[model samples]
Target chain A: MSCWETLADYALRSVGIGERLLPRSDFTICQQVVLIGSGMIWNVYFGVLALCSGFFLATAVALGKASHSVWLRKPSEWFIFIFRGSPLFIQFFFAYFLFLSLKQVAPIFTPFTSAWAGALVVLFLNTAAYSGEIFYGALLSIPKGDTEAADAYGFSGWARFRRIIWPTMLRLAWPAYTNEAIFLFHATTLVFFSGFPAQQQRGDALYYANYFADKTFNPFIPYPILAGYFILLTLLLIGLFGLVNRRLNRHLPRERRAKVRFRPNVIR
Target chain B: MFSYCADPDTLSGLTWLSCYLTTGKHMAFYVSFGTVLLLLAITAPTALLFGFGGAAAARARFFPLRWVGKAYISVVRGVPDIAFFLFFVIALDQGFEWLRHKVKCPDWDQPIRQGSDFVVCDAAKLPLGNAAQWVHETYGFFLAVLTFAIVFGAFAANVLFGAMRAVPHAQLETAEAYGMTQRQTFWRILVPQMWVYALPGLSNLWMVLIKATPLLFLLGVEDIVYWARELGGTKTPRFTDYPHGDWRMWYFLVLLIFYLAFTRVSEVVLDRVMKKLTHGQATAGGEAQRKAA
Candidate 1:
C-alpha cells in the first residue's frame, strides 16, 4: 500500500482507530513510521494528562513538606522519599500488580488493570513526587523579603501564599520543573513496558518501536524514528515551558531572567 | 540449600519457608541483587572514564573533534533512555558480529541482511555461538554495561563540561602567569578545580545510575527484576514444590524497598563524603563549615 494509505490506515491505530490489525509481515518503512507515529498519540495522552493533574498535587506536596506541623510534614516527606528513591520502572511493576489485586477485590477498580488508568496513576504520583521535591526546594529558597513585603501589605495565610509566595516559588522552580516535565514525557514510554498490558496493542511510541524492532530484527530504523519524534517533543516542551518561564520571570530584567536549560535527568 | 530442601513437597510451615528461601532459584534471585551492585561497581567508573573523554574532547580546540564531542554529549538528552538501552543492546550486538564477520569471513558473504534475519557466519557470532552459558550471560552483561556507560556518560559529560566552564577564566590566566604550560595548567589547575564543581552533578548522576541498574532486565540479564518476575509467578505442583498463587506484587514490593533503602543509604553516605571533601575548600559548604567553627 501507498504511504498515504498506510498513514490513513494506521495513523490513529494506537488508540484502536482505522487499523484493526497491525501489519505483521513484509513491514514497510511507511508502515513503521505511521504505526509508530500513531503510537505517539498515547505518549502525548499520558504525558499531558499526567503532567496536568500532577501539577496541583505537586504544589500540595511542596506545601506539605514545608508545613510546620509534623502531621503534614512527615507524610509529605515520606511520600517524596519513597517515590523519588525507587526506580520508576519498579514502581510501575509494583503498581500494576497492586492494581491487578485491587481489581480482583472490587469491580470499581477494574479500569486500573488496563494501561490507561493504571499507568496514568503511577506516572501522576511519580512526577508529583519528583516535581514536589523541586517545588519544596523552591519554596524554601523563596526570598524572605518577598514574604515580609506580603506581610507588610496585610497579605495573610492563603492570600499571602496565593498572591506573594506561589508565583515566586514557581519562578524559582521553573527551570528544574521544565526538566521534570521532559523526563515525565520520556517516562510515559515505560507504561506499556511495565506490567500494565497494552489492551489491543494500544501502546506508546517505545512500544511500537519495540514491536518493529522485534519483527524486522532491525533496531536502526524504528528506534531512530522514535528518537526523532521524542526530540521534537522535547524541543516543543522546552518551547512551551520557555513561554511559561518568561511569564514567571517577566518582571525581572532580561539578563537576570532564568533560561529554561535542557539538563535531562537520565533516570528517575 | 538445606538437606531437607531436597523434598519440599513433604515440608510445611516455617520448615517449608526456610527450604523455599534457600532453593537454587532463590539463590539466583539473591545473586541477582549482587548483579545489580556489580553492574553499578563496573559501570560507574567506566562511565566516568567515558564522560571524562567526552568532556576533554568537547574542550578540544579542533572544530571537528569538538563537534564530535558535543554530539556525543547531547545524543542521550532528548530521547527516552529506555529507547537508547533497547536500541544499543541489539545494535551493539549486531555491530560486533558484523565487524567480526568482516574480519573473519571476508570472502563468504552473500548478505548479512536476509529479509528479517541478521545472519553473520557461525564463526562471527558473539561468544562464538557455541560458548558456555556463562559466556553468553557475560556477553549480555557486557553489552548492558556498555550501553549504560554510553548513555550516562553523555549526562556526565554535560555536567563535566558545565563544570569545566564554571572553572573561572582567571584560574587559567594565573596559571599562565606562573609559566605553566597548557597541559600543566589543565592537569594541575583546571582539572583539580573542575572536580569541586563536578562533584554535585556527578553525585546526582551516581544516584541515577543506581536506579538504572534495574534496566538490565530489559537487556535480558537475570537481574533482580527478572528474578522477581520469575519467582513470583504462580507455580503449580508440576513445576516445583513451592506451589503458590501469583505474588508478583509482593516480589515487586520487595524490589521497591530494596531500591528505596539503597538510595537512602547512598544519600546519607554521599552527604558525609561531600562534607569531608568540602571541609577546607572555598566552596559554600566549606564556608559554612568555617562559620560553624
Candidate 2:
C-alpha cells in the first residue's frame, strides 16, 4: 500500500483506531514512524496528566513534610520514603498487582485494571513522592531570614505560609522540580513494561517500538524513532519548565536567581 | 531444603509455607537478589573506570578527544535509558556477530542483513551456537552489565569532571612552580582532591544504579521480577505439584519490600562512606567533623 494509505490506516493504530491487525511483514519505515508516533500519544497523555496532577499533590506533600505537627509530617515522610525508596519499575508491578487484586475484590472498581486509572495512579503517587522530597528539601532550605521577616511583619500561620513560605519553597524548588518532571516523563515509558496490561494492543511508544523490533527482527529503526520522539518531548518539557523557573525567580536579582541547570547525573 | 520438606503436599499451614518459600523457584528468586548485588559490585567499578577514562579524555588538550568525551556524556543524558537498553543490546549483539563472521568464516560471503535475517555462518555465532544454556545466560548478563556501565559511565564522567575542576587551582599551579610535570600534578593533587568533591554525586549515582537493577528483567534475565511473575501466577493442579490462586500481589509486595530494604541499607552505607570520604576535606561536612572533634 501507499505511504498515505498506510498513514491513514495506522495513524491512530495505537489506540486501536484504524487497523484491526498490526502490519506483520514488509514493515515499512512509514508504518513504523506512523504507528510509533501514534503510540507517543499515550506517552504524552500519561506524562501530561500525571505531571499536572502530581504537581498539586506534590506541593501539598512538600508542605505536609515541612509542617511542625507530627500528624502532618510522619505520614508525608512515610509516603515519600515508600515511593522514592523503591524502583519505579517495581512500583509499576506492585501497583498493577495491587490493582488486579483490588479488581477481584470489587469488579465495580474494574476500572483500576486499565492503564488510565491503574498506571496513572502509580505515576501520580510516584511523582508526588519524588517531587515531595525535592520540595521538602527546598522547604527546609528556605531562608530562615525570610520566615523571620514574615514574623516581624506580623504575618502568621496561614497568611505567613501563603505570603512567604509557599512562594519561596516553589522558587527554591523549581530547578529540582524541573529535573523531576523530566525523569517522570522518562519513567512513564515503563508503564506498559510493568504488569499493567496494554489491553487491545493499545500501548505507548516504547511498547510499539518493541512490537516493531520483534516483528522485523531489527531493533535499529523503531527504537531510534521512539528515542527521537522522546528527545523532542524532553526538549519541550525543558522549555516549559524553563519558562516557569524564570517566572518563579523573576523577583530575584539576576545573579541571585538560580538558573535551571541540567544535572541528570545526580539521580534523585 | 530440609529432609522433612521433600514432600510438599504432606506439609500444612506454617510448615507448608516454610517448604513453599524454600522451593527451588524461590531459591532462584533469592539468587536473583544476589544477581542485583553482583551487578552493582561489577558495574560500579567498571563504570568508574570508564568514567575515569572519559573524564581524562575530556580534560585532555586535544579538541576532538574533548568533544568525543563531551558527546558521550550529553547524548546518554539526552535520551531515556530504556531506549539505550533497547538499542544497544541488539546493536551490540549484531556487531559482535558480524565481527565473528568476518574473523571465523572468512570464506562465507553472503549478506548478513538480507531483509530481516541477520545470518552469519554457524561458526560465527556468539558462544559458537552450541554453547551451554549457562553461557548464553552469562553472555546476556554480560551485555546488560556493559549497557549499564556505558550509560552510567557518562553520569560518572560528568561527576568526575566537575570534581576535577573543583580541585584547588593553586595546588596545580604550585606543583607547576615546583617543576612537577602535568601528569604528576594530576595524579598527586587533582585525583586525590577530586574524590572528596565526587563522593556526593557518586553516592547519588550508586543509589540510582541500585534502583536500575530491576531493568535486568527487561533484558530477559531471570531476575527477581521475572521469577516473581513466574512463580506467582495461578498454578492449576494439572500443571504443577502445588495448586494456588493468583498470588502475584503478595509476590510483588515481597519484591517491593526487598527493594525498599536494599535502598535503605544502601542509603546507610553510602552515608557512612560519604562521611569517611569527606573527613578532613575543605567541605562543610568535614568542617562539621572538625568541630565535633
Candidate 3:
C-alpha cells in the first residue's frame, strides 16, 4: 500500500481509532511515524491533565509543608518524602497492584486498575510531590522584606497569602516548576512500561516506538523519531512556560527578572 | 528450611511464612537486590569517568572534539532517558556483533541484515552461542551497565562542564601568571576547585542514578521488579508448597520502602559530604562556615 494510505490507516492506530490491527509485516517508515505520532496524543493527555490538576494540590502541599501546624505539616512532609524518594517505576507497579487488590475489596476501584486511571493517579501524585518541593523551597526563600511589607499594610492570613505571598512564591518557583513539568512529561513514557497494560495497544509515544522496534528489530529509526517528537514537545513546554514566567516577572525591573534556562539536574 | 514446614498445608502463621520466604526462588529474589546494588556500585565510577572525559573533551581546544563533547552532553536534555536506555542496549549489541562479523568472518558474509533478523556467524555472536549460562548473564549485565553509564554520563558531563566554568576565571589567570602550562593549570587549579561547584549537581545526579536503578528490569535483567511480579502472583497449591492470593501489592510496597529508605540515607550522606567538600572552598558554603567559626 502507498505511504499516504498507510498514514490514513495507522495515524490514530495507538488509540484504536483508525486501524484495527497494527501493520505486522513490511512496516514502512510512514507507518512507524504515524503510529508513534498518534501515540503522542496519550503522552500529551497524561502530562497536561496531571500538570494542570497537580498544580493546585502542589500549592496546597507546599503551603502545608511550610505551615506551623503539626497536623498539616507532618502528612505533607511525608507525602513529599515518599513520592520524591521512591522511583516512579516502582510507584506505578505498587499503585497498579494496590488498585487491583482494592478492586477485590470494593468494585469502585475497578477503573483504578487500568492504565488510564491508575497510571494517571501515580503521575499526578509524583508530579505533585516534585512540584511541591520546588514550591516549598521557593516559599522558604521568598524575601523576608516582602512579607514584612505585607504585614505593615494589615494584609493578614488568607489575604496576605493571596495578595502578597502566592504570586511571589510562584514567581520564584516558575523556572524549577518548568523543569518539573518537562520531566513529568518525559516520565509519562514510563506508564506503559510498568505493569499497566496499554488496553488495545492504546499506549504512549514510547510504547508505539517500542512496538515498531520490536517488530522491525531495528532500534535506529523509531527511537530517533520518538526523540525528535519529544524534543519538539520539550521545546513547546519551555516556550509555554516562558510566557507565564515573563508575566510573573513583568512588574520587576529587567535586571531583576529571572531567565528560564533549561537546567537538566532538577529531577528527583 | 524447617522440617515441620515441609507440610505447608498443615502449617500456619509464622512457621508457614518462614518456609515461604526461604524458598529457592525467594533466595534469587533476595539476590537481585544485590544485583541492583552491584549495578549502582559499578555504574557510578564508570559514569563519572565517562563524564570527566566528556567534560574535558567539551573544553578541548580542537573544534570538532568540542562539538562532539557538547553534543554528547546536550543529547540527554531533549529526549526521555528511557528511550536511550532501550535504544542503546540493542544498538550496541548489534554494533558489536557487526564489527565482530567483519573481523571474524569477512569471506563468509551472507548479508548481516537479512530482513529483520541480525544473522551474524556463530563466532561473531556476543558470547559465541554455546557459551555458559553465566557468560550470557554476565554479558547482558555488562551491556546494561554500559548503557546506564552512557546515558548518565551525559547528565554528569553537563554538571561537570558547568562546574568547570564556575571555577572563577581569576584562578586560571593566576595559574597562567605563575607560568603554569594549560594542562597543569587544568589539573592543579581548575579540577581541584570545580568540585565545590560540582558537588550539588553531582549529589543530585547521584540521587537520580539511585532512582533510575529500576530501569534495569527493562533491559531484561531479572531485577527486583521482575521478582516482585513473579513471586507475588497467585499460585495454586498444586503448583507449589506455599500458595497464596495475589500479594503483589505487598511485594511492591516493600520495594518502594527499600528505594525510599535508600534515597533518604543517600541524601543524609551526600549532605555531610557536601559540607566536608566545601570546608575550605571559595563558595557560599565556605563563607557560611567561616562566619559560624
Candidate 4:
C-alpha cells in the first residue's frame, strides 16, 4: 500500500479513528511514523488534561502547605510527601490494583481500571505534588515587603493573597513549574507503560514505539521516530510555557527575567 | 519457610498470617527490595563517573570530542527515559549479539536481519543460549545497570556541567597563577569547588533515581513490582494450601510504604550531608549557618 493510504488508515489510529487493526507484520516506516505519531495523541491528551486540572489542585495544595493552621498544613504535607516520595511507577501499580479492587466493589469505578482514567489520575496527583512543592518553595521565597505593602494598601486575607502573594509566588515558581510541566509531559509516556491497561491496543507514542520495536526487532527506527515526536512536543510545551513565563514576569526588566531553559528532572 | 508453614491449612489467625508471609514467593518479594537497593548502590557511582566523563569531554579542546560529549548530555533532555530504557535494552542486546555474530560466524551465509527476526549464530548468543538461569538473570541485570547508568549519566552530566561552570573564575585564575595546568586545575581545584554547587542538583537527581527503580520490572527484571504482581494475584485452594483473595493491592501498598520510608530517610541524611558540606563555605547556606552559630 502507499504511504498516503497508510497515513490515512493509521494517522488517528491511537484515538481509534481510522484504523481498527494495527500493522501486524512487514511494517513500513510510514506505518510506524503514522501510528506512533497517532499515539502521541494520547500523550498530549493525558498531558494537557492532567496538567490543566492539576494546576488548580496544585495551587490549593501550595496554599495549604503555606497555611498557618496545622490542620491544613499537615494534610498538605502528607499528601505532597506521599505522592512525591513514592515512585509514580509504583503509585500506578498500587493505584491500578486499588482501583481494580474498587471496581469489584462498585460498577462506577470500572473505568478507573483502564489507562485513560486511572493513569491520568496518577499523573494528575503526581504532577500536583511536584508542582505544589515548587509553588510552596516559591511562596516561602516571596519578598516580605510585598505583603507589608499590601497591608498598607488596605489589602488583607484573600484580597492580599490574590493581589500581592499569589502572583509573585507564580512568577517565582514559573521556571521550576516549567520544568515540572516538561517532566509531567514526559511522565505521560509512563501512563500506558504502567499497570493501567490500554484498551483496544490504543496507546500513547511510547506504547506504539514499544510495539514497533517488538515487531521489527529494530529499535533504531521506531524509537528515534518516537523521540522526534517528543522533541517536537517538548519544544511546543516550552514555547507555550515560555509564553506564560513571559506574562508572569512581564513587569521584570529583561536582565531580571528568568529564562525557561530545559532542566530535565524526570518522574517528579 | 517456618515449621507452621508446613501445614498452612491447619493454621489460623496470626499463625496463618505469619506462615503466609513466610512463603517462598513472599521471600522473593522481600529480596526484591534488596535488588532495588543494589541497583541504586551500583548505578549511583557508575553514573556519576559516566557523567563526569561526559561533562569533561564536553569541555574538551577537540571539537568532535566536545560534540560527542554534548550529544551524550542532551540525548535524554526532551525524551522520556522510559522510552530510552525500552529502546536501549533490545538495541544493546541485539547490538552485542550482532558484534559476536560477526566475530564468531564470519562464514555464515544468511543475513542477520531477516524480515523481523534478528538472527545470530547460537554460538554468538549473549551468555550463550543454554546458559544457566542465574547467568541469564545476571546478564539482564548487567544490561539494566548499563541502561540506568547511561540515562542517569546524562542528567548527572548536565548538573556537573553547570556546576563546573559555576566555580568562581578567580579560583581557576589563582590555580593558573600557581602554574597549575588546565588538567591539574580541573582535577585539584575545580572538581573540589564544583561539588558544592553540584550537590543540590545531584541530590534531586538521586531522589529521581530512587523513584525510577520500579521501572526495572518493565525491563523484565523480577523487581518488587514483578514479585508484588506475582504474589498478590488471587490464589485458589487448588494452587496453594493457604488460599486467599486478590491481595495485590496490599502487597503494592507495602511496596509503597517501603519507598516512602526509604525516601524520607534519604532526605534526612541528605539534609545532614548538605549542612556538613556547607558548614564553612561561603554560600547562602553557609551564611545561614554562620548567623545561627
Candidate 5:
C-alpha cells in the first residue's frame, strides 16, 4: 500500500483507532514513523493526565509532609519515601499484581487490573511522590521573612497559605517540577514493558519502536524516531513550564527572576 | 534442606512452606540478587571510567573529539533512558556479531540481514552455537553491563563535565602561575578538586543506577523481577508441591522492601562520604564544617 494509506491506517494505531494488525514485514520508514508517532498519543495521554491529577495531590502531600501534626506528617513522609525510593519498574509490577489481587477480593477493582487504570494510578502516585518531595524542599526553603510578612498583613492560616506561601513554594519548585514532568513523560514508556498488556497491541512509543526493531532486525530507525518525538515533547514541556515559571515570578524584577535551566537528573 | 521436606507432596503446614522456599528455583532466585549486586559493582567503576573519558574528551583541544564527547553527554538529555536501554542491547549484540562475521568469515558473503534474521556463521556467533550455558549467560550479562555503563556514562559525564566547570578557574590559574603545566594542573589540581562538586550529582546518579538494576530483566537476564513473576504465579498442586494462589504482590512487596532498604543505606553512606570529601574543601559544605570545627 501507499505510504499515505499506511499513515492513515497506522497513525492512530496505538489507541486502537485505525490499523488492527501492525506491519509485520516489508516495513517502510513511513510505517515506523506513523506507528511510533501514533504510539506517542498514549505517552501524551498518560503524561498529561497523570501530571495534571498528580499536581493537586503533590501539593497536599507537600503540606502533609511539612505539617505540624504527627498524624498527617508520618503517612506523607512514608508515602513519599516508598514511592521515591523504589524503582518505578518494580512499582509498576507491584501495583499491577496488587490491583490484580484486589480484583480477586472485590469485583470493583476489576477495571483497575487493566493497564488503563492501573498504570495510570501508578504513574500518578509516583509523580506525586517525587513532585511532593520537590515541593516539600521548596516549602522548607521559603524565607521566614515571607511568613512573617504574611503575619504582618494579618493573613492567617488558609489565607496565609493560599496568598503568600503556595505561590512562592511553587516558584521555588518549578524547575525541579519541570524535570519531574519530563521524566514522568519519559517514564510512561515503562507501563507496557511492566507487564501491563497494551490492549489490542496498542502501546506507547517505545513499544512500537521496540516492535519495529524486533521485526526489521534494525534498531537505527525506530528508536531514533521515538527519541525525536520525545525531544520535541521535552522541548514543548520546557516551553510550557517556562511560561508558568514566568507567571510565578512575574512580580520579581527581571534581574531577580530565575532563568529555567534544564538539568536532567533521574528523579525516579 | 530438612529431611522431612524431601517429599513435599506429603508435607503440610510449616514443613511444606519451608521446603517450597528452599526449592532449587528459590536458590536461583536468591542468586539473582547477587547478579544485580555484581552488575552494580562492575558497572559503577566502568561507567565512571567512561564518564571520565567522556568529560576529558569533551575538554580536549581537538574540535572533533570535543564534539563527539559533547554529543555523548547530551544524548541522554533528550530521550528516555529506557529507550537507550532497549535499543543498545540488540544493536550492540548485532554489532559484535557483525564484526566477528567480517573477521571470522570474510568470504562467506550471505548477506547478514536476510529479511529479519541476522545470520552469522557459527564461528561468528557471540557464544558460539555450542558454547556452554554459563558462557551464554555470562555474555548476556556482560552486554547488559556494557549497555548500562554506556547510558549511565553519559549521565555521569554530564555531572562530571559540570563538576569540572564548577571547579574555580582561579585554582587552575594559580596552578599555572606556580609553573604547573596544563596536564599537571588537570591531574593534580582539577581532578582532585572536582569530586567535591561532583559528589552530589554522582550520589544522585548512584541512586539512579541502583533503581535501574531491575531493567536487567528487560535485557533477558533472569533477574529478580523475572523470578517474582515466575514464582508468584498461581500453581496447581498437580504441577508441583507449592500450589498457591497468585502471590506476586507479596513477592513484589519483598522486592520493594529490598530496594527501599538499599536506597536508605546508600543515602546514609553517601552522606557520610560527602562529609568526608567536603572537609577543608573550598565549598559551602566545607565552610560549614570549618565553622563547626
Candidate 6:
C-alpha cells in the first residue's frame, strides 16, 4: 500500500476513527509514525487540559496554603503533600480504583471509568499539587516591599492580591512553572499504564508505541517515533512558556529580567 | 498460622483476617517493598557516579568528549523517561545477545532478525536461555537498575553541572593563590562548595527516583503493584482456600499510603542531610544555623 493510503487509514486510528482493528501481522515505519502521531493527540489533550485547569487551581491552592486561616491552609497543605509525595503511576491506579468504587456507589458516573475522565482527573490533581508547591515557594519569596506599597496605597485583601500579590507570585513562580509544565506533559505517558483502561485501544503515545512493539517485537522503530513526537512537544512547550515568561517579566528592566532556561530535572 | 487459621472455612473474625494477610502471596507483597528500597539504595550512588563522570566530561577541554557528555544529558532529558525504560530494556538485551553471538558463533551465518524472530545461537543467549527462572529474574532486575541509573544519571548530571558552576570562582582562585594544583583546588574547594548547591536539586531528584520505583511493575518486576493486582483480583473458591471479592482498590490504597510514607521519611532524612551539608556555608540555611548555635 502507498504511504498516503497507509496514513489515511491510521491517521485517526488512535481515537477509534478509521480502523476498527489495529494492523496485525505486518507493521511498517509509516504505520508506526501515523499511529504514534495519532496517539500524541491524546498526550497533548491530557497535558493541555490538565495544565490549563491546574493553573487556576494551583493559584487557589497556593493562596490557600499561605492563608492566615488554618482551615484553609491545612487542607491545601495535605492535598499538595499527598499528590506530590506519591508517584503519578500510583495516583493513576489509586484514582482509577477509587473512581471505580465511586461508580459502584453511583452507577450514573460510569463514564469516569474511561481514560478521558479518569486519567484527566488524576493529572489535574497531580499537576495542581506540584504547581501549588512551586507557587507556594514563589508566594513566600514575593518581595515584601510590594505588599507594603500596596498597603500604603490603601490596598487590602482582594485589591492587594489582584494588583500586587498575585502577579508577583506568578512572576516568581514562572520558571518553576515551566518545569512543572514539561514534567506534567511527560507524566501524561503514564496514564495508560495505570489502572485506567484505554477504551478500544484509544490510548496515548506510549500506549500506541507499546502496541506496535508488542505486534512486531521490535522496539527500534516505534519507540524512537514516540520520542521524536515528545521532544517536539517539549520544545513547543518551552517556546510557549518562554513567550509567557517574557510577558510576565515585561515590567522589569532588561538586565533585571530572568531568562528562563531548561533545568532538565523534574522536581517532584 | 494458628490451628484455627489452618481451616479458613471454620474460622471467623480476626483469626481469619490475620491468616489471610499472612499467606504466601502476601509475604511476597511485603518483600516487594524491600525490592523498591533496594533499587533506590543501589541506583542512587550509581547514578551519582554516572552524573559526576558526565559533568566532568562536559567540562573537559576536548570538544568531542564535551559533545558526548552534553548529548548524554540532553538525550535522556529530551524524551519521556518511560519510553527509555521500555526501549532500553529490549535494545540492551538484543545488543548483549548480538555481541555474544558474534564472539561465540562467528561461523554461524544467519540474520538475527529473520521474520520478527531474534534467534541468536543458543549458547549466545543471555543467561544461556535454559538458566533457572531466578537467573532470568535477576537479569531483569539488573536491566531495570541499569535503565533507572542511566535515566536518573542525566538529571543528576544536569544538577551537578549547575552546582559545579555555582561554586564561587574566588574560592578556586584563592586555592590557586595558595599554590594548590588545579586538581587539588578542585578536590578541596570546588567539590566541597558544590555539595551545598547540589543538595537541593539532588534531594528533589531523590524524591522523584523514589516515586519512580513503581515503574518496575511495568518492567515486569513483581513489585507492590504486581502483587496488588495478583492478590486483590476476584479469587474464586476453586482457585484458593480463602477467596475474596474485588479488593484491588483497597490494595492500591495501601500501596499509595506506603509510597507517601516512604516519600515523607526520605524528605525528612534528606532535609537533615541538607542541614548538615549547609553548616558553615554562606547560604541562608548556614546563617540560620550559625545564629541558632
Best by DockQ: 1
lDDT of 3 by residue, B160-240 (tens): 999999999999999999999999999999998998899898888899999999999999999999999999999988899
> DockQ of candidates 1 onward, in order?
0.84, 0.65, 0.71, 0.78, 0.75, 0.67
Cα lDDT tens digits, model 6, A1-268, are 8789888888887788887788786777888899899999899999999999999999999999999999999999999999998888988888888788789889976877889988898899999999999999999998889988899999998888898998899899998899889988888998898888888888888999999887777899899999899889988988999999999999999998877777655423
DockQ for candidate 5, C-alpha atoms:
0.75
lDDT of 1 by residue, B1-293 (tens): 78877878788999998988888899999999999999999999999999998999999999899999999987777578899999999999999999999999999749899999999889999988679999999999999999999999888888999999988899999999999998999999999888878988998999999888888988999999999999999899997879998899999999999999999999999898888888888878889999999
Q: Which pairs clash in model 6?
A: none
Model 2 misplaced regions, further than 4 Å: A265-268
Candidate 2: deviation at residue A220, Å? Answer: 1.9
The alpha-carbon deviation from the true structure for residue B266 of candidate 5, after best TM-score superposition, in angstroms, is 0.4
> Across residues A1-268, which tens digit of lDDT does each residue of candidate 4 receive?
9999998999988878897988899999989999999999999988899999999899999999999999999999999999999998889889999999999889899999988888889989988998999999999999889888888889988888887898999999998998888888888888877778878999999999999888888999999998899888888888998999999889988999889877776654
Worst 10 residues of 4 chain B by lDDT: B74-83
List, residue by residue over B1-293, the lDDT tens digit for candidate 2.
87878777787888888878888888998999899889899999999998998898888889999999888888888878787787788888888998989998899878888887878999889976789999999999999899889989998998999999998888899999999998899898889889989988888888898888889889878898999999999999887766789899899889889888988998999889888988898888999999999
lDDT of 3: 0.91
Determine which window of 10 residues in candidate 6 chain B has minimal summed lDDT. Answer: B1-10
- Cα displacement (angstroms), candidate 5, residue B58, comes to 1.1
Report how far off residue A176 is in candidate 5 (Å).
Answer: 1.0
C-alpha lDDT of all candidate models, in order: 0.91, 0.87, 0.91, 0.90, 0.92, 0.88
lDDT of 6 by residue, B91-139 (tens): 8888999999999999998888887678899999998767999999999
Model 3 ranges with Cα > 4 A deviation: A265-268
Model 1 stretches with alpha carbons more than 4 Å out: none
lDDT of 5: 0.92
Residue pairs in collision within model 2: none
The most accurate candidate by lDDT is 5
lDDT of 5 by residue, A88-163 (tens): 9999999999999988889999888888889999999999999999999999999999999899989998989999
| TM-score between candidate 6 and the true structure | 0.97
Per-prediction TM-score to the true structure, in the order listed: 0.97, 0.97, 0.98, 0.97, 0.98, 0.97
Cα lDDT for residue A150, model 5? Answer: 92
lDDT over C-alpha atoms for residue A178 of model 2: 86
Model 2 agreement with the true structure over A1-268: per-residue lDDT tens digits: 9999989998998788898788888889999999989988888888889989998899899889888999999999999999988888988888888878888888976888889888998999989999989988999998989999999999998999888998999999988888888888888788898888888899998999999887777898999898899888878988998998888888989999888876654223
Residue A169 of model 4, lDDT score: 95
Q: How does model 4 do on interface RMSD, in angstroms?
A: 1.1
Better of 2 and 5 by lDDT: 5
